[model samples]
Structures are given as C-alpha cells and as structure tokens.
Target: MALNYDEIVGKFDKYIFNTYTRQPIAIKKACGAVVTDVNGKEYIDCVAGIAVNNVGHCHPAVVEAIKRQSEQLIHVYNLYYTEQQALLAEGLVNLTEMDRIFFCNSGAEAVEGALKLARKATGKKVFIATEHAFHGRTRGALSVTHKEKYRKPFEPLAPAVFVPYNDAGAIREAITNDTAGVILEPVQGEAGVIIPDDGYLGEIREICDETGTLMILDEVQTGFGRTGKWFAREHSGIKPDIMTLAKAMGGGFPMGAKLAREDVAANFGRGDHASTFGGNALSCAVALSNIEVIKKEKLVAKASDLGAYLMEELKALDKDYVKEVRGKGLMVGMELSIKCEDIVAKARECGVLLNCTSDSVLRFVPPLMISKEQLDTVVGVINEI
Candidate 1:
C-alpha cells in the first residue's frame, strides 16, 4: 500500500497541464536542505524551490505558525483585517521606508499589482521593461515580461517597450513622456543571475526621477536576504519607487507583495484593485514566521558569509567546463563554457539538485540556511560534473 514513481507520473500526466518538462524524480519527504525521493534516495536541494524556501523546508517556526494560525483564524479575507497581516505590514514598513503594502498570492500577482499601481498613479498605459526578463505568467505581469517565448502567444501585450538590460543609455533613451513605469530585476534571476554595472541602479533611479517614471524593482527572486542585504538594490544605495516581492517571502507558502511610497500608493482607493485570497490570514501567519525565523536565526548574515564561502569554493573548481562564478550572497550563477543541462543532470546523480538558467548559465539559489559542509558537498558535485 505505497506509492511508486511510475504511478505518480502517470497520474500527473493525465491530470496536469503539459507545460514544464519535469524531471522523473518524485520527492516524498523533505527537511532542511535535503529532499528524499520515494525510493529513499536523498539529494541536496540547491534550487530551494527556486528560491522560495529561503529558510529551508518545513522550518519548525514556520510550521508552528501555520498550525497555530489555522487553528485560530485560517482564511480571513483582505476585506476584513487581521492582526497577523497588520504586524507583517508594519514589519515590512520598518524594514523599508516604503509606505503602503498590497499582499497577493504569488510573484506574478505582485508584479500585476505593481504595474496597476504605476498606471493608476501616473495615469499612463505604457510600461518599459528589459529584454530577457521573466516576470510572471499572468496577463498583466506577462505583458511586461520581455521573453518572446513567454509573450508571443499572448501578443499585443499592454503596450510594453523592451529595453536592453544593464544599459543605462538604452534605458534613458527608452524613457518617453508616455512611459508609465520601468521594471527590472536588480539581479536578473531567470536571465542567469545577471548583475548590472556597479552604478546602474543609481543611474536608473536618476532616470526615473528626471523622466517622471515610476521605478519598479522586481525583487521576486532576490529579496528576503538572498542578496546579502535585504534587497539587492540596497547594495547600490538606490531606492525604487515601487518594489515587488515574492518567492522567499512566504517560506514556500504562496504569497507576494508590492511596496510603494505612501502618496504614490494612495492613488488606488477603495476597490481600485482587489484579490479574493490576497492577504489571507494563513499566508500572513506563514510569511510572518518566515521573516521572524530569518531575523531570529540571523540567516541574512549567514547568507552573506556562506555565500562568500560558496563562491570561493566554486572558483577553486575553475575548469574547462566552468566558465565564471559570480554572485552576491546566496544568489550565485555559474556561466558554463558549454551548455549546463548535462552537468546539472550529472550533479543530480551526485546527490545535488541545481538548476540551469537560460541555456548556458547554471543558477545556484540554495536556502539561506545552507551549512558550510553542505556547500562543500555542492563543490564536490561540481567537481564530479
């Protein structure tokens, strides 16, 4: 009376949509940075659910919070307020000077809300995003995503202009009077952890200031201490007009938020925009627990230290297959000399779970709580590959 991999895959193929070419591994149980398949083979989860498990899987504090909240008040809609949501909002405001917050269900919804805020506040319809960007799949967020594969089917997408990423001149040139907002990931996560030039964010801030455009930072994959600092742009000492956050915010629970300056946030009044399950009590409890654990455990500082160690270890593996390793905090990327898919597959055999970004770059976004020994294991796997 047990489940097998074949049975699981057959059920999924019948019921699930044919979108992602998923691996054949069926994860049965997970804890910390490791997941065990149904056959009891363990693999280090270097992907960390694509950076959504910043604190690690089934963190005790997060689990306790979810249990307590479900027993107390599980699904209080955003229409009615709750203490957990208020506390989370206050913590966020204290964390950043941003004024208002809109809680949503995922990264895509957060991007959607941010764009709506920009358009509503500026009274403009056009958005400027960077090429090779991957925001989300929703209609509003998808419109601004610059990848053709993600946008071609949904053509005539919301009058969005695609600019080259990391080019300040091109971004400045693209800023017309009609531009409603400019959105870009501080370090492009899906675009291969692409770090812009040192002064690029400040340049963007200046441009947004001069052109009267709302600056939006898509921190979906980079926020919640992945980038050493709380947010990657903080490294540049630049403030965005609106910043969208998700991924690690909920510690695996589906949650996202758009943070904006108070006056700018005020543009949307009663029912200007709404979501049915947007700030539900359960998500708030989970998100709060995630943040609490991050702070209590000082995982941010750990990310800074271990990330440095990981980088140093990776660079030691500089071989013909290895191209370059660059990262800030736990968010690292390895630009391979060749396509990295097989290398990743080989690493999976070596008891590690890493992912490839684009076709050539290998992305390393492990949990912020990854131990030095675990990182050493990662290095050994790379050496095997």
Candidate 2:
C-alpha cells in the first residue's frame, strides 16, 4: 500500500504532535546530496537532514555496519560493556583530544550531560552562555540557550547569564562566584552562521582559565567534517574543557556524546549518568563506521575545498538583496535584506532544498560529498530566483 503526500500529512495532523513547521513534500528516500519526494521528483539536498548526514544519506559503509551489528547484537543496557562501545569511546577521545567520554542519544542529551558535569565538577549553580546561542531544548540545556521565545514560557529556569557573543569582556563581567561553566558554539549555526572574530575563542579560553570556569564547546551541528575539520574547535587551536558531539556523529543514526578532561570527568561517579540505549552495539557500530568513512574518504579536505568553491559562487551572484555571505567550510550562510521563507519555498519548487535560519539567513550545510556540478546547479537556481 502506497501513501500519497496528503495521506501522510493527514496522518501526521491526526496522530503527531504539532511542533515542526514541515515542508510540503514528503521525502521518500535520499542518497548523496539528492532526495526524491513521494511523487518521484528529485531535489538537490542542501539541508542534509539539518546537517546530520555528513557522509551522505545511507552511505554503504554505515548501512553495512548497521546490518552487521544487528546480526550480532542490536542493543543491551549500558550495564554490560560492549566491545563496540569501548572502541567508539577510544576513537572519540583520540579524535576530540578529550580525556573522558559519556554516551547519550541526541544533541540535547549531550548538552544536558555536559551541563550536569560542569555543575558537578565546579560545585557551582550558575552558567554563562552567549547571546543568539542554541545549545538544545531540554530543561537544563534550554536554561542556557539564548532565544527568549524558547526560554520565556519555561520561566524560573536554572540560573544562567547571557552575554553578547564575540565579546570576551562581557563573559568576564558575567562570571560570578557561583559560575559553573561557559557554553558556546564555535560557529553560531542557527543564528545565521555567525562567525566570531579571529581571536574571540582564544580570548574566551583565556578568560575561562583566569576565572576557573569550564569551557563547553557545543559541536552538535559543526562536527564530523561539517566545518571542514574533524571538529570546529580546531579552527581556533583551543581545547574545550567539555565538548558536546552529535548530529553527524552517527551518520544519521541517533547518537550523541559528552567529552571532558579526565579530572572534570571524575566528578561523575559510577551511577551519576547513564543512558539505557546509548552506546548500545548498534549505535556504537554505526558511529565507529561513520568515523572510519569520514577519515577514509578524506571528506574533511573535500569540505574545505568545495566549501570555498560554493561560497565563492554564491558571492558572485547578484548582491542586490544579499547582505553577507560568510562561514567556514561547508557551513556557509547568505544573509539577505529580505526574509528567506518565500525564497526557500521558491528554491524547493525549483528542485533544491534550502533552510532559512534567523529569519533572513539562508543556511547552506550540504553533504560533504556533494558534487561541484550539483552545487553549481544550486547556485544557478538561486541566481535565477
């Protein structure tokens, strides 16, 4: 039995919670920078599952890893250690240069874990976050997230101070005796791909060290070759005290992790934090394979080269409405004087998928494997629009 678009939409309306502002077309399947709708029309996928499919959708390695792992073992509670989990932990620590790791299911769970670890390590209750930052939507993560609309309804959240981004002085002033940690995204993804000044992150690191506060870098959207490097922090050459990883971590499989220095990680005892489904055989296998594929394919270098190409092409486009074009690697954004909702719909109609963030910024986070020809077509379509 095949369901049409209306049928799927009707079912969602009747059965699903009304939260997401969904696009009209229902994607049937996706592969390597392209998605086919139920009606069989294909669109160049620029969104990349909101930057989740870094290795491209259903990459052979990831699919095979999932199949092989399922045959051996699908899932077991974290009570029993699994070889896959241990291997994945080692791989993550080596890649991230963090001393310890904690597994979880999604970006929000990772942020929640990082926040808890920060508080526990420093014995502090207050956190300082940057303005226009988006960590996650969970209660603890939401408290540090900077969007008022998301934070207003749930008042009396955990104590946190919001400071202007790219300003180390504001962070210094915000730190109090009860401050636990400071959390920030290396590149502000949801806020129009906002890239801070060259020395901003280093300044924050210095201030955090001076104040004895933990520095938590949220790499949920910017990790795993999305930003042309294994991790965005490499751009600054600073090691965060705590880091959150997800989004592309499992190559579309649900997985997240919180990593910290060894001493900071000691704050969490045996029973302090555990996820029932996290680090199970299947997720760990998928994540391990995802990392292997990223390394073997050399997608990091590909991202750096192609991202430069994409941004240059976009910059060449007529700038009558374009306010700015900026980003690092594959994480580029085009801010327009006009709102981007109508432009997004028009692009979708013209056989491309685009995401509008911060009301006016058109975010482009395509798969690292997207071809130059496909990206050229995407730019052509936007230019024609």
Candidate 3:
C-alpha cells in the first residue's frame, strides 16, 4: 500500500504539537547522500539530518544491524545487561581515554546526566557555561542553553553563570568556590558554528584544574567524525574531564552517552541515575553497528579528506553575499552578509537540501560517505542559491 504524504501531514497537524517549523515535503526514504520526497523527487542531502547521519541515510550495515538486533531482542531496562551495550560502551571509551560511560537517550539527556554527575562530584550548585551556547531544550539543559528566546519564558534556570566563550579571563573571574562545572562546545553548533580561539580548550582545562570545576565538552554535533576526527578533542590535544555525545552515535537511532574519568565517575554510584530506555538492546545494537561501519568504511579519514576539499571549494566560491567559509572537516559554515532562510527553500528547488543556522550562516554537514562529485553538486547549489 502506498502511503499518501498529504494525508499523513493532515493527520499529523491534527495530533502533533506545533513546536517545530518543519519543511512542507515529507521524506519517504533516503540512501547515501540523497533523500526522496513522497512524490519521489530526489534532493541532495547536505544537512545530513542536522549532522545526525554522518554515515549517510539508511546505511546498509546500520540497517542490517538494527534488523538483526530487533529480531534478537528489542527492549530491556538498565537493570539487565547485553553484549551490545558492552560493545557500544567499549567502542565509546576506546575513542577517548575517558574512564567510564553513562548511557542515555538523546543529546539533551546526556547533557542532563553529565550535569548531575558533575554537581554530585563537586557538591556545588553553580555552573559556568559559555554565552551563545546551546546545551539542549529540556529544563536542565535549557537552563544551560544561553539563548534569550529559549530561556526567557523558562525563568530560573539551573543556577548557572554565563561567561564569554574563548575568554579565559572571564572564565577565571566567574569560577569561584561554588562553581561546580564549566560546560562548553569545542565549536558552537547552534550559534552559527562558532569556533573558539587556539588555546580555548586547554585554557578551559587549566581553569577547571585551578578551581576544581568539572570540564564538560558537549560533543553532540561535533563528535563521530563530523569534525574530521573521531572527536574534536583530538584536534586540540586536550582530553576533557567529561564529554557528552549523541546525534550520530546510533546512525539515526535515539542514543546518547557521557564519558568521564573514573575518579570523576565515582560520584555516581548504583541507582544514582538511570533512563528507562537507556542502554536498551536496540539502541546499543544500532550504535555498535554505527561505530563498526565508521571504522570498517574508514569514514573518519574520509571526513577529513572530503571536508578539506569541500572547504576549499566553498572558499573558492566567488559570491558577493558570502562573508566567510570556516569550519573543520565536514562541518563547514558559510556566513552570508544577507539573510538566508529562503536558501533552504531555494536549494530544495535546485534539487539540493541545506540548512541555515542563525540568520546568515549556512551550515553544511553532509554524510561522510558523500563523494567529491556529490559535494560539487551541493556546492554548486549553494553558489547558485
């Protein structure tokens, strides 16, 4: 039976909450760097589902793993353990020298869980976050998120102080005895993909060391080869005390995790915190496959090579409206002098899909599997748009 997208959209409008300003078309299926609408129109996917599909859409290995795991076991609470969960955890910790892993459900949940763990370790109530940072949308995560529109209505966010990112002095000034942790993104994702100064991460690590503050890096968007590395920290050579990850970990499945040093993890003991669906068989299975595919396919190295090529192509573009093109690896952003919301719509018309962050910067985080020729189409669309 063929599903009618318009009928489903009508039904969705009747039942779903009006929270997101979604695109009009419905994506029925996707493969590699392309997604097809309900009417079967093929569009080049440069957004990669907001950087969540680093391995590409409906990857054969990921789909097969999910299928195999579903037949093996679907759901089991955190009280019980599975080999998939162990493999996923091992894969995560192996990426970084971090000591422990705490499984969760989404990027926001990982942030909340990491916040709780940090507070417990320091026994402090205050936190220091960077200005223009977006941790997440949940109450706890929202409290740390610094956007006024997102934070205004929800007053009295967790007792947190916002400091200017990349300013080591402001961080030092803000960190007092009561400060529990300082959480930041290596490169700001939602804030127009802002990159910090050269020594920002190392400086933050130093400040945390001086103040006994837990340093947390929210690598939700920057993790899993999106920034051309296994993790963005690899570029800086500074390992964080705690790091949160999600988005691409499950290859489109709902999964998030927090990696922390063993000493720091000692604060959260048995029954300290657990998600009903965290570390479930299905999600872990998918994550295991996601990691394996990234490894076997060598998407991490591909991301680096392709990212540099894309950046060069974007930078080489001669557009009066383009102010700059900057980002690491596959995570490139072009800041335009003019508003670009319509670029999303216009790009789609040109048989390409893109995303705009803030009011002017266009973000490009295509799948790691995209070939250089496919990227040429994406770049050509942007130049024409």
Candidate 4:
C-alpha cells in the first residue's frame, strides 16, 4: 500500500534537503492533466511539474518507451555510442535547427555546458544576461541569474553582466571586447512568464552579429509546445548560435541538452566535455517517444489555439486585483496587485493546482493536451475564488 500524506511528509522532513518550499498535499498518481493526492482528491494540475510534463503526466508513449528501454538497456556511459542516443541527437538537432548536441542531466547542467562552450568557442570569459532572467541554479548559470536572494549566497561567480529585459540598447551597450556571448530566455519563465516584444529578440540577434558575440537562447522552460511554437524563439524567427533545452525535453523524464551551430560546435573537441549519464539509453528513448507524442498529437498547434482562448478567458476575470494577463501560449501569467500565494492555496482547495511566481504573478502552465472544458473549469474556479 502507498504511504499516506503524513507518512510521506515525515520521511521527507527527515531525509530530504530543505531546498524547496513545497505544496501541502502529496500526489499519489497523475494521468494527463489531472493529479490525485494521497487522500484520493483529484486536482487539475496547472503546474505540470513546473512545465516539465508538457505531454502530460504518465503519457502512455513515454511510459512504454521507458519500460521497453529499461528492459533492453539503461546506462552504458559516454565511452560507447548507443542507437537511442544517436537517434535522439538527430531529432533534437533537427527540431532545434542546430548542428551539434551535448546531452546533460538537467537545465542547470545544460546551461553549464552552454556557458563553457561559449567561452571555449569565442575564447572569452564574459556573458551578458538580462534582468529578471532565470537560467538555472548552478554556479555558472547562477552568475547570469539576476535575483539577489539566489545570487547573494554565492558571490565571486563567473563573469557576466546584467541588462534589462526587452531593451536591446542595454544589451548592445553591455557587449564588450571580452564578452563571450549573451544568454537569454526567449520568454522569461521564472520572471512571471515575461514575454518579449516582437522585435526584441531580432534586435538582440543583430547586435550579437555586429559584435561577433554568440547568441545563447535558454529555452529550458519555454521549449517543447509550452509556448505555442516548438520554441519561443520561433515567435521572433531568430536563430540562436547556441541553445539550451531541458524542462519538457523528456516529457517529465530528467534530461537536458545544449545545441550549437556548426562552426561554433567545432570548438569542443572530443575530451572537452562529457557526462556519464547524459544521454543514457533510457532517457533518449523516453525523449524520442515524447517528441513523437508532441508531433503525433499536433500539440504545438493546440497550444496556440488553447493559449488564445485561455488568455481571453483570464482577461475577462472579474477580480479587480488582476493587474495584467499576458503570455504567448500555455505559459500564461496573471499579474495581480496583491500577492498570489493565498489564491494559489485557495485554488488547490478548489481542486485546481496553481503556481505563484515573483510574488504577485500567478503562472498558468497547464498541459498542452488539456481539454477546453478543463481550462474553463480552472478559470471558473479562480474567478469564484
């Protein structure tokens, strides 16, 4: 029998690191857009594992792929090439429109790999990042991250200059002789789902081209079908020199990768970077299945259609506290004048899961496959609350 919520919490308090400020209820199982708590209460999962379960929880194809690959082989290290790894590499390269791939374990590792590649490729040390941008939590990724609370604990980080988001002039001015590249999230996820202006990314691309600096797009949270397109960068039609991906890559399975253009990727020789379990057979198989699920279900287009409907519905919310409702697709955010934590808790009580980020922004990153009725219910619950 499964342990009850109290039992789980007791074990977690004793064994787990106190890193995350977790939600109260303990999840038992999930299918598609819904998750059931240990008390057998079903909640519409708007969090979607913080945008990792894009294809939805326990997607049949992904589950099958994991099972099949685990039976055949799991990890064989990076010394030898595997068919699953090769296939996934080809798929990701084609999807990302990049020339090369470096598999890693998570978003932070992908950022680390991208940062190192940028420095090695350009023979420079500085990286230009934007304010309110969140890449990851590792040392190198943390340096580019803007929040003082996350950065203050670890000082003397790698060389990176911060610029304001959506301001191309600041980026242009920040580029220096020693600047290796500019790392940015096409749609800033952790910063209240901030979307850039139409011309913002294109202008930055031009500035990077003019200065001979690499453009590194961190699509960790915005990749897959989360932002209407396969990538948020697609909205701007700008190709980044190097790109980092992770969140929804494996469809809830942990995996990440760094992609780079042909010329830029050539700088990383055989021994320069490697990960023991980066592209293990199990992860690659699951990722391949996840990509196939996204394509087969036409989830990209669905996200576009549903995102429009969701935005319209959110904009019609009765609450005067709603300051703004903005997003590209499923990755929508409702900015409220008041802190949204209480609302999040209330939503959970109403059988809907929600996430509050940046204090006042309620982020809504539901599954790409969520039904319109389900979305309406989610919005209605919030409205009632």
Candidate 5:
C-alpha cells in the first residue's frame, strides 16, 4: 500500500503542535544529498536537515552502528555505566580540548546545561549574549537568545544582557561583577550566516580571562565539520571555557553535549544535574560512528573545498537579487535584496530544496558529500530564479 500524503498532512494538522510553518513536502526517503517525496519525486537537498546531517542522510556506518547497538542495548538510563556513553565522551574530549562532557538529547539541552554549569562555576547570575544570536528555544537558552520575537512571549526569562555581535569592545564593557559568562555562536547562523571579524573570538577569550568570566561557544550549527574544521572556534585559535554541541553530532540521530574544562565542569555536584534519556546507548553509538565517518571520509577538508567553490560560483553570478554571499565551509548563506521565501518555493518547484532565514538570506548547508555537479544544479536554479 502506498502512503497517503494528504491524509498524513491532515493527521499532522490535527495531532501535531503548530510550531513550524513547514514546507508542503512529505519527505519519505533520503540518501546522501537527495530526498524523495512521498510521491517519488526526488530533490537535491541543500538544507541537510537544518545542518544536522553532516555525514549525509542515512550514512551506512552510522546506520550500522545504530542497528548493532540497538540489538545489544538501547537505553539503560544514566544511572548505570554504559560503554558507548563513556567512549563517546572520550572521543569528544579528544577532539576538543575540553576536559569533561555532559551528554544530553538536543542542542537546547546542551545550552541549558552550559548555562547552569557557568552559573555554578562562577557563582554569578547574569549572562551576556550577542544580538541576532540563537541558542535554543528552552527557557535558559531562550533567555540568552537575542531575538525579541522569540523572547518576547516568554518574558521574565533568566536575566541576561544582549550586545551587538562582532564587537569585542561591547563585550568587554558588558562584563561586570555579576556576569557569569558570555555565550556566542562562532558564526551566527540564524541571523544569516554572519561571520565575525578575524580577532573577535580571541578578543572575547582575553576579556573573559581578565574578568574571571566563563566563555561559552554555541557550535550547534558550526560543529562536526560544518565550518570546515571540527569546530568553528578553531578558525579563531581560541578555546572557550564551555562549548555546546549538537545538530550533526548524532549523524541524524538526536543527541547533544556540553563540554567544559576540568575545574569548570567539577562545579556540578552529584545531584546538580541529570537527564533521564541523555547519554543513551543508541545515540552514543550513532554519534561515535558519525565522528568516525567524518574522520575516515575526510569530510572536513571536502566541506572546505566544496564550500569555497560553491560560494565563488554564486558570487561570480551576475544576479540582481544577490546582495551578499558569505559563510564558512558548508554553511553558506546568500543574502538577497528581495524576500527569499518565494525564491525558496520556486527552487523547490525546480527539484531543488533550499531554506531562507531572517526573511532574505538563502541558507545553503548541504551535505558534505554533495558533489560540485549537484551544486552546479543548485546554483543554476538560483540563477534562473
């Protein structure tokens, strides 16, 4: 029996929460850089599950790891020791300079954990975040997020101060006695793939060191080879005190983690924090394979190479609507003079999938495995639009 697209959509309308104004496509299968709709129409995927499919959709290694782990153990909770969880932590710590890691289930949970750890470590109440920044939708993460529209409805959130991004002087001025930490995205994603100045991250690190303030980097969108490097902070040569990671970490499986230095992470007591489903065997196994695939397939360097090519091709195009093209690695964004929603719809009609953020910036975070030929098709479609 074939799947009923309209009936499935109707069921979603009646049963699911109306949180997302989703595109009218029922994706039923995906592999590498393409997705097939319920009706069997295939489209070249550029969103990569909003930057969560760094290893590409349904990577063989990741799928095998998940399947093998599921046959052995799926969930044992955090109370008991699990080999997969321990190995994942070791892998994360080895990849990053951080000494300890706390696993969770999503990017939002990681951000929330990082916030709590910062407050506990510094014994402070306030946090400074950048304007146009997006951490997560959870209350603690939402508190530091800078958008008025997302934070307005959930007013009276945790006390946080907001400042302009890419401005080191503002961050220095914002830090005070009550400031626990400063959190920022190495390259702002939701606000249109905004990359900061060369020395911005290093400057923030110096200021945090001078003021005894914890520095947190939200790498939810930029981690796991998305920004060419394993993490975007490597581009700036600065290691933050706390780093939040998710999105691509699980290789399409849901997972998140908050990493911190030894002394900083030690602030959390035995009863300080816990998650019922966090660090489960299934997610850990998949994440381990995800990292392994990235290393084995050399996807990081591939992303760097292909991202440059894509950006160059887009910039070289003589288009009136293109205002700017900027980003690092596979996380590129094309700013347009006109609204991009219609362009995205048109691209979908042309057998290409695209996403627009901040109304006018067309975000292109395709699978690292996307070929230059496939990218040419995407660029050709955009040029036509």
Candidate 6:
C-alpha cells in the first residue's frame, strides 16, 4: 500500500522533534540528481542533501562497498583494530599533507575534535574564527561559529574571538599569545557561499606561522571535489595545520574526520579522545569507495567544467531580484536583493528543489555528477521564476 504525504507528515509531527521546517513533499526515493515524492512527482535535486551526496545519491560503487563490508564486519569499538579503518586513514593522509586522521561521525564532531587537538597541542585556550561562519552546532563548534542567532542561546561557549571573513589585518590583530588556532571555512557555506579574496587564505597561513597559531579549516562542505579540487585549500595553494571533513566523505553514509600535522596530532595520547562509532568498518569501507569514485570518474574536473557553465548561465539571467551569483565548483549561490522565501517555494512547485540560506541567498549545491541537461532544466525553472 502506498502511503500518502499527509500520513507521513502526520507521523513526523506526532513523533519527531520539530527542528527543521521541512518542505511539503514527502520524499520516497532518490537516484542520481533526482528525488521522487510520495505522489510520484520527480524533482531535480539541487540541494544534494546539503552537499552530502557529492558523488550523487547512492552511487553503485559506494553501495557495493557498504554491502560487502556490512556482510563481513559492520563495526568494532575503537579499542579494537580494524583494517577498514586503517586503510581509510592511510587514504586520507595520502590525499592531504596531514599526517594523522581522527575519525568522527559528523562535521560538528570533526570541528570539536579539531578544537580539542589545537588546545592540547598549543596549550592555549583562545581561538579566532570568522564572522558569519557556521562550523557546527555542538558546544565546541558552536563557540567558534560566528552567527549570533546560533550562538546567543548557547551562552558561555568556549573562549573565542570573531573577525571579518576576508580581512587579514583583523585576523592578525585578533591573534594573541593565548590563541591556540584560527578557524574559518574556505568558502562560508551557511553564510550564503561567501568566497574570500584570492590571497586571503595564504595571508592567514603566513600570519599563523608568525604567531604560532594553528590554521584550522572547516572543509565539511567544500572538501572532496565539491570545490573543483580535492579540497578548497588547494585553490589558494595553502595547507592548513588542521582540516575538518565530513559531508560527502561517507558517500551518503555518516562519517567525519579531523586531519592534522604529525607534531600537532602527537599532543594526544591513547584514550585522550575517542568515539565508539568513529572508525566503524561500514563507514570506512564506503568512504574509501567514495574517494575512489571521485578519482576514477574524474568528478573534480567535471565539477570544474560544469560549475563554470552553471555560474555563467546563472549570471546571464535577467532577473531584477538577483544581487550576485558566486561560488566555486558545485557549491554555488545566487544572492537576492530581497527575501527569497517565496522564490524557494515557487521553485519547488515548478519541479525543482533549491535551498534558501542566510535568509536571501539561493544556495545550489547539486551533486557533482549532475548532468548538463538537468542543469539546463534547473536554469529554465529559475528563469520562469
């Protein structure tokens, strides 16, 4: 028997916590860049699970890897050794310059681990974060996040200082001997895809060296080919002292990791920090396959080519509401002059799924494997709006 949208929504309202303002449609299934609702209406998925499905929803290789690993070994606590976990760590270390990888379950947990590592490594208590940055909602990650709406309710957060996103001078001025690290998103995702100046990250890297501050980058949304490179930091030719990753790493499964330089990571001894499900075999196997898919299919290059085309097409739109069109790779945003709540609703009604973040910016973080024809359809829908 087919369940109706009303029945699904009623169950959610009756049993689940009302945290998110969900769309009207009840999604029944997803494949590639499209999702089908209970009514069997298909919509082009531009949100891509908020940039979590970089290789598209349930890529065959990822699904196979998860199934194979699940049948062999689903999990063992971190106390036990697992070949899947060890292999995934090696893959991450080889992908970046970082020497050690600490696995967690989500981006927020990655950020939290990064913070604790920095403090332990530097013996400092203060951190410097950028304005409008959205690291995560956990208390440690929340402290460094800049949005007051998210932070105001959670008072007495970890000690931190907020500075303008792209201002090198402010970051330099904010740093003190007490500062353990400086954290920022390479491209602020929740702040409406705010891209920094070309040399901003490099400048911060130099300052961190001068002040002995660890440069921590929250690449939860911008990592794993979402930004044309393996990591967005590659665009600036800078290597952060610590990098936090999660979304897309698990190929639709839940996982996160914090990578750091050897000496920085050496500050912690065994049992200093741990997660029961952090390095589970299931997530590790799937993440390994996810990384393999990104490389084997050359999705990074695809994102670069298609992202450029999408940006150009969006910029060509003659809409009066458009204030700016900016982003890197598949993480694009169209800022509007006025509130865009109505625009989002209209897009959904027109068989397209879009996200409105920072109140007025229309965020389009579609799957990296989204087709040109699908993108054309998305643009046509936007044109009609």
Candidate 4, residues 1-385, lDDT tens digits: the string is 8899999999999999999999999998999999999999999999999999999999999999999999999999998989999999999999988899999999999999999999999999999999999988999999999999999989989988999999999999998899999999998889999988999999999999999999999999999989999998899999999999998999999999999999999999989999989999999999999999999999999999999999999998857899999998899999999999999999999999999999999999999999999999999999999
Cα lDDT over the full model 6: 0.94
User: What is candidate 6's lDDT per residue for 145-261, written digit by digit as tens?
Assistant: 988888999899999999999999999999988999999999999999999999999999999999889999999999999989999999999999999999999988999999999
How many clashes in each candidate?
0, 0, 0, 0, 0, 0
* Model 1 TM-score (2 dp): 0.98
Clashes counted in candidate 6 amount to 0
In terms of lDDT, the poorest run of 10 residues in model 4 is 314-323
TM-score of each: 0.98, 0.99, 0.98, 0.99, 0.99, 0.99
Predicted candidate 2: what Cα RMSD to the true structure? 0.7
User: Model 1, poorest ten-residue lDDT window?
Assistant: 72-81
Model 5: per-residue Cα lDDT over 1-385, one tens digit each:
8667998899999999999989999999999999999988899999999999988899999989988999999999987999999999999999988999999999999999999999999889999999999999999999999889999999999999999999999999999899999999999999999999999999999999998999999999999999899999999999999999999999999999999999999999898989988999999999999999999999999999999999999999968878999989999999999999999999999999999999999999999989999999999998887
lDDT of 2 at 323: 95
In candidate 4, which residue ranges exceed 4 Å CA deviation? none
Q: Candidate 6 — which pairs collide?
A: none
Q: Between 2 and 3, whose lDDT is larger? A: 2
lDDT of 3 by residue, 283-331 (tens): 9999988998899999999999998899899889978888988888888
Q: How much lDDT does each candidate structure score? A: 0.90, 0.94, 0.90, 0.95, 0.95, 0.94
How far in Å is the alpha carbon of 126 misplaced in model 1? Answer: 1.2
- Which is the better candidate, 2 or 3, if ranked by TM-score? 2
User: Residue 133's C-alpha lDDT in candidate 6?
Assistant: 91
Worst 10-residue stretch by lDDT in candidate 6?
Answer: 1-10
Candidate 5 TM-score, C-alpha based? 0.99
lDDT of 2: 0.94
